[model samples]
Target: MARVMRDATVAATAEKIFAACGPSWLGDSYNHWSAAVKAWAVGATRSLPDDDRRAIVYKTQELDDALMAARRALEEEDDE
Candidate 1:
């Protein structure tokens, strides 16, 4: 289905963006990248069916959580 395909693409994109952030990028830069990815994914997912949209939304949320975790780790590293 179209929804499935859309979700798959979004998932892959989110993973790549998150991976690119890596451990070296932190704070404002990390936040900026994550925000941009989230916005883009959300915009792309909007056209999907409700069920498909929901899956994409959850992945977005998970990405957000990962970004926060990554940010926190970066901050902690900075503190040390």
Candidate 2:
């Protein structure tokens, strides 16, 4: 079974993942999974100060973006 990641340190959004390939995806991609998995991590991130929170959130977002991009590349490789 697919496990949905949940925690205070991870955050992600399926919207971004799904949008990466447009609406007409042939099947599930890594990006979709990555976003779902990462969304919660980003959401759960916590910091004592607002500035710290901002930095952490941005870092998480960037990591998620990179993972999504990597997934897209992998998918393309499989398609070819």
The lDDT leader among the candidates is 1
Assess candidate 2 and give its TM-score to the true structure.
Answer: 0.42
Clashing pairs in 1: none
Model 2 C-alpha lDDT per residue in residues 8-51, reported as the tens digit of each score = 33243334433443433324444444444455446555423434
Clashes of each: 0, 12
lDDT of each: 0.58, 0.46
Give the TM-score of each candidate: 0.46, 0.42
The positional error of residue 42 in candidate 2, measured at the CA in angstroms, is 14
